[model samples]
Target: MSGDRGAVELEGVTKRFGSMVAVDSVNLSVKPGEFLSLLGPSGCGKTTTLRMLAGFEQPDSGFIRISGEYVQGVPPYKRDVNTVFQHYALFPHMTVAENVAYGLRQKGVPKSEIAAKVAEALDMVQMSKLAERKPRQMSGGQQQRVAVARALVNRPSVLLLDEPLGALDRKLREEMQIELKLLQSRLGITFIFVTHDQEEAMSMSDRIAIMLDGHIEQLGEPETVYEHPSSAFVAGFIGRNNFWQGVATEHGIRADDGTEFVASRPEEDVPNGQPALAAVRPECINLSAERPADSNNVTAGVVAGVSHFGDVLQYVVSVKDRDLLVLTPRAHAARFQQDDNVFCHWSADDVYLFSARQADIVMTDGDEEIHDN
Candidate 1:
């Protein structure tokens, strides 16, 4: 592995599996030392894209560049990158130190140098104390740390993580997320992480490439993608949203459910009377006992259910034939009970209006799903 700048680039990359295109003609540029995440649902080509970068899968068209060098025919071991898969894939019979040294030994590295590198890698992941433990004897989180250490031992310019923390319990996964981020920052190594979990991507990535149907749907920082999604699919996938199918109007959309929206900041411009989709985030909606005076972006509903999260309250309001999710901070929640009449209102600025091109793909029930384009 070379100590070069870890910038990566993909130019018009495409891959097909028996006529099923896994990665369409896609282009991307990753900056050196940047933590970028490839995020999307299953079959959205995020993993395929990672494989191509790792030299495990070659693109049928286009090309990839790692550390400023073309890697079209490069083998996995020859590439200046290391991959940490969802499964740690550690040698069950080997001690943590031996497992981390396996790659170095295979490459004919001197035993003296390998030991020093292995010790340093284990220390980096805080696994130095457990260097002699076998995989079967250690906890999942501890084993994962060893796996990371093994990858880091080679000193690759770029590290690729494919849902590396997916196997851990929620609390442990969160703990690893913070630890990995801090480690990446300290190492100043470019990390390309692949995960379908939006929260993981949002929390750990400096920028996220939201893939859809073999292409990049949106690429931006966590806040940029969440606050201003490029499409309805991106919006729905990034967070909980209430979507309405309707026709575009001068000011906004008039939903088929008879509710009207006035979006001062519509994401797309749809000509009047054309089909469109309107979206409002759960936290953006406000619930009140009295109807709002404003005419637009307000609807009468009855509280269908209420659930309490640690610091927030979730309310399911039934308006017409649909249920809208509303999230409020516990400190400011009005404490509406089930079956209580309430009004759901949002500001025009809070509404996201887009063309109905993705109407069939948008999950109206607040579920995250990205269908094939």
Candidate 2:
């Protein structure tokens, strides 16, 4: 809208639907030209928040600013933002070029100018060669490219992407992730991506706002949030970890089996005597025939399960009180078989501690959380 910082801000943003509060009072800020993601499970208000930004929905109480200008009442058509939806909602009767030019035509741009801009937008998405093709004639990926070109053709300062790659196959989704990021960078536009997919958000966003229950649970750069989760929800949501139910002590945390896990961090800062959760990723666990010398957290466990993931081998090991996960590099020459007795050792630095704030998660049956780390 104005200048390049592509700044987007939300202060005390609250949205309500009848008796239900879809988005609680939330605060967020995005730097100009930054790729930020609203990441969480369904019903977490990510889509609602995005719709608010695009002016399709209004917040009950909040201020939204784009490019440093307040846009509380500005409608979608007047706002300098373009949306690329999950479905490639293209016009069936129009070719890619015509679809892209539709917006400019509605604005009544000169015929010559519209043609030039349409060609440029298609070229920007590497879809110029297919400009004459209709949406039904193209693959999912190609159709989505046309959608992207249509959104970009408007030259909006901010791009709002609502799961733009959700319809593609796995490999194609991954490829589009990289490609879309490159396009965002090359165009230097501010992008706000919404998704329930953790990996997609992690791969593309400069910063991720992890949301839950109508609030943002954590917001940070991908690596920072992954390595230093601020809450139990984050530690369990971000990455695969072996979780242990425990009680907090001043020195460390005591697992249910009475095994004390001393992390590089302390449990004293956590409420003493409260239920706690300790987690460590599979790759952080060390596997050996015997306990590693000078290891702080080591356990004897049986290989409960093992699976090959190309470059890495993932193992689920059952210790006396806790089930630990161990990830071994495929390059490692040593191998273990299922049911083999082994010692799993991990450094304190690899451990994360959290309060048992989500007892409900233990009762849930399905794995709906993204676990972005």
Cα TM-score per model: 0.96, 0.94
Clashing pairs in 2: 5-32, 237-371, 238-371, 238-372, 238-373
Candidate 2 segments exceeding 4 Å error: 1-5, 266-268, 362-373
For model 2, how does the per-residue alpha-carbon lDDT over 103-207 read when each residue is reduced to its tens digit? 999988899899999999999999999988989999999999999999999899899999899899999999999999999999889999998787888889899
Question: TM-score of the candidate numbered 2?
Answer: 0.94
The lDDT leader among the candidates is 1
lDDT of 1 by residue, 110-148 (tens): 988999999999999999999988899999999999999
Model 2 is weakest, by summed lDDT over 10 consecutive residues, at 363-372
Residue range with the least summed lDDT across 10 consecutive positions in model 1? 364-373
RMSD of each: 2.1, 2.8
**Clash totals in order:** 0, 5
lDDT of 1: 0.91
